[model samples]
Target: MKFQLDEQQGGNAISRHDGQCVWVNGQPHRASLLVPWRGEVQPWPLSRFEDLTEAHFEQILACKPELVVFGSGARIRFARPQLYRSLIQARIGVETMDLGAACRTYNVLASEGRAVLAALLIDPE
Candidate 1:
């Protein structure tokens, strides 16, 4: 599905549903669906992260965010150097932290209206 972002609500604004997956803007996202997102919980119908490709990164780049946060599941040092370099070359800052910290940081920056995109991974059970 197509995902449309609600720019006015900011990052704290998340769409939530009961059993159905949450859609961010209009596109189905699974960033928060795989776990309990404490902030603005939303339904993301997508099943896997592999579906998120370089095109997704390009779209996010359009946001002209100051920083991009990647939540690599529960691991602290699982960052993709190539992706990180790409963002840096575009003048965007990148941070690879655990999912929990990434969520908290994303909310804070999002609320502040900072251009920040969070690519969070699901915690393995």
Candidate 2:
């Protein structure tokens, strides 16, 4: 689906997304990636929800966002809390949803100037 956020001065926004890929700032990406509000976009190195691990969450922590909008491919899937205990203990919130929803919500939160990260996984298929 075509997704967009009001072009803010900084922060990455998803311009489009399909189950297999997402366009960040109009650049198409088939692999998982991390888009932090007002920061550089980086590869997340994940293809599916099952591939998630503590290391991935730690990577998100490195971005230092107040919240993470996790896009679990084309379906809504919740990661085990233990996978993100560090974020919880750090008081950073995580909201899990499908890629489409995450993209849309990320746009809204990001536009509001919230410190947010979009942890999106594109289906390997």
CA lDDT, candidate 1, residue 40: 37
User: For candidate 1, what is the TM-score?
Assistant: 0.55
Compared with the true structure, what per-residue lDDT tens digits does model 1 show for residues 77-119?
Answer: 5445554455668988777786567655665676666766665
Clashes of 1: 13
C-alpha lDDT (0 to 100) for residue 22 of candidate 2? 89
Q: What is the model-wide C-alpha lDDT for candidate 1?
A: 0.52
Predicted candidate 2 versus true structure: per-residue lDDT over 11-123, tens digit per residue: 77888898888898888988999989886789998876787899999999988999999998888889999999999999999999999999989988998889999999888
Per-model root-mean-square deviation over C-alphas: 8.9, 2.7
Residue pairs clashing, model 2 = 11-38
Candidate 1: segments with Cα more than 4 A from true spot: 1-59, 123-125
